[model samples]
Target: MVKIGIADTTFARFDMGKAAIDELKRNCSAQIVRYTVPGIKDLPVACKKLFDEQHCDIVMALGMPGSKPVDKTCAHEASMGIIICQLMTGRHIIEVFVHEDEAPDARELAALMEKRAREHALNVVKLMFKPKILEKEAGTGQRQGYEDVGPARI
Candidate 1:
């Protein structure tokens, strides 16, 4: 059985991890492992632990960055760390970051988080079980939380 890992932050106002897990459960038969930390900066290590200790085949690093410059900086740094962790482990980490500024209100922000997390969860399923589906979606300009921009007209 496939094992999917989820690393999330309490700094987030919403529970994006739950959304991802729900989606995963609806679509696949994978063993889901979750690790929660206090802030976005801690997601990388949490993901690493899930991979190393729990032996997850893939991971989703979910975070919600506040609408501030400092928060943006921290989010970027966390993203880089996640990349490095992926490189070190030779596995895929789907970084799902929803900035608080992306939406005008808390309700919208929460909705966005759920949409993005669920969509990425589907991507995880495709990656693990049906990668050919992803190949078919290449260059389609897919968007998770909002309307897709569609492929560019050259």
Candidate 2:
């Protein structure tokens, strides 16, 4: 399985990211791990933990643009954040920005992120993990496979 790590910087408690990951799980078999950071500045340590400990094959950041529009797009900001992650940890990264209002918008962003990952020569799978409020399945574990990968051997 492709080890994938997803980080969400948005204020929401990874709701959007969870949606996106669910969609990906249906189509692709990737080891998706989701994270939510308090803010943008706290991303480095978070990325370090994801990259170093998780041993993620791909690291993708999720940015959600709410109703009140921001000047810069989430994709743009995520790209910059990916750079910081790359520099800090010497690992290839991919970032996807999901426009939550419309489902099509999220799909469009996912495609773009995938293309960007390809351009960067990284075996990365990037997409928007949108969140949904569906009823949970009975007997299914709530927190499945969200464990840490331990330290990387030098």
Candidate that would win on TM-score: 1
TM per candidate comes to 0.98, 0.50
Candidate with top lDDT is 1
Q: After superposition, how far is residue 10 of candidate 2 from its true place, in Å?
A: 4.6
Model 2 Cα RMSD, Å?
A: 14.9
- The number of clashing residue pairs in each candidate reads 0, 6
Write the residue-wise lDDT of candidate 2 on 1-154 in tens digits.
6677767676532344565565556556768777778644445556667888888766656554543455245445656766877887777555544344434465554554343323222213322221121123223432211233444455
- Kindly report which residue stretches of model 2 are placed more than 4 angstroms away from their true locations once superposed: 10-14, 65-81, 88-90, 98-154
List model 1 lDDT by residue over 1-154, tens digit each: 9999999989899999999999999999999999999999999999999999999999999999889999999999999999999999999999999999999999999999999999999999999999999999999999988898889987
- Determine which window of 10 residues in candidate 1 has minimal summed lDDT: 145-154
